[model samples]
Target chain A: AQTVTQSQPEMSVQEAETVTLSCTYDTSESDYYLFWYKQPPSRQMILVIRQEAYKQQNATENRFSVNFQKAAKSFSLKISDSQLGDAAMYFCAYRSGSNYKLTFGKGTLLTVNP
Target chain B: GAGVSQSPSNKVTEKGKDVELRCDPISGHTALYWYRQSLGQGLEFLIYFQGNSAPDKSGLPSDRFSAERTGGSVSTLTIQRTQQEDSAVYLCASSLRPSGPTEAFFGQGTRLTVV
Candidate 1:
């Protein structure tokens, strides 16, 4: 069984600053995918970024990027130029390449303060 | 209709009563998933359906919880004799494919409250 862990329960970042949320997972499979999802107060979960284990280069989307260290089993999300809209519960998820089910972390509530 | 749709945005039922939650995935999606999110917790996988393949119910917490997808389109999650602990937000997501690099679109989710 694969499990994702987000050590931080809550995080705060000043407007226009950067924030990094830590995530780690336990998986024996070499082929897998990691994702960061944002769930706002509206209860809608939105995909932030995705990283393939086979890719050495980290994935970057707009201001969101991931620091994926496959050997360390670590996948952290970095948000640059943080805005108020970035305030939400961020979840780190893992999915086996052979399977479609997703395992998610407890989530870190991000508060972007102006 | 453009995205995953979950019925009864909010449901409040008495303990021991039976409740049903519906999910309408995006058209043409081959994969659908159900997840439960308790307050202050992460999303918990409940069930998954991929095309005509047998659904994966491994994540179901108890036998009291069951789900079905009809015609590989709509899905319903039923809870018999619902307990107070069953109160949580039920989320549904669908992706074009079950494998490879794909993105799953999610619904707003149904907030179930068993009192």
Candidate 2:
């Protein structure tokens, strides 16, 4: 079984500043996928970014990037030039390359301050 | 519909009563999933359907909970003798393909309340 952990229950960041959300996972499989999902008050889960375990280079999507450390089983998301739209409940998820099911963390509520 | 659609955006039922939740995935998507989110439990995977067949059902909390997808398109999750613990938001998602890199698109989700 694979499990994802987000230690931060809540986080706040100033607009135009940067924020990092930490995530860790436990898995015995060598190949897998990691993702960050955002859910606003609307309760709609949206995919923010994805990273493949085999890729040594981190994944970056505009202002969103990740710091993936395979040996440490860590995958953290970094949001730069943070905007109010970035405020949401962020979840870290894991999926085995061989399977489609996603295991998600408890999530960290992010608040962007003006 | 353009995205995953879940019926009865909100459902409130009495304890011990049966409840049914429906999900209609994206038109061409072959993979569908069900998940539960509550205050106590953040997000819990419920079941996965590849087409009309379920490849994994391990996440179903109990035998009282069951789900089925028909014609590889619509799915229904049924809970019998529901308990207060079953109160949560039921989310449905669909992906274009099975496994690997495809990101799943989610529905608005159905908030279930057992009283």
- Compared with the true structure, what per-residue lDDT tens digits does model 2 show for residues B26-80? 9999999999999845689999999756458899999999999988999999999
Per-residue CA lDDT of candidate 1, range B18-51, in tens? 9999999999999999999999889999999999
Candidate achieving the largest lDDT? 1
**CAPRI verdict (incorrect, acceptable, medium, high) for model 2:** medium
- Checking candidate 2 for backbone clashes, the offending pairs are none
How many residue-pair clashes does candidate 1 contain?
A: 0
The TM-score between candidate 2 and the true structure equals: 0.97
Assign candidate 1 its CAPRI class: high
lDDT of each: 0.95, 0.94
The residue-level lDDT of candidate 2 at B74 comes to 95
Worst 10 residues of 1 chain A by lDDT: A94-103
Q: Could you give the DockQ of candidate 1?
A: 0.83
Off by over 4 Å in 2: none
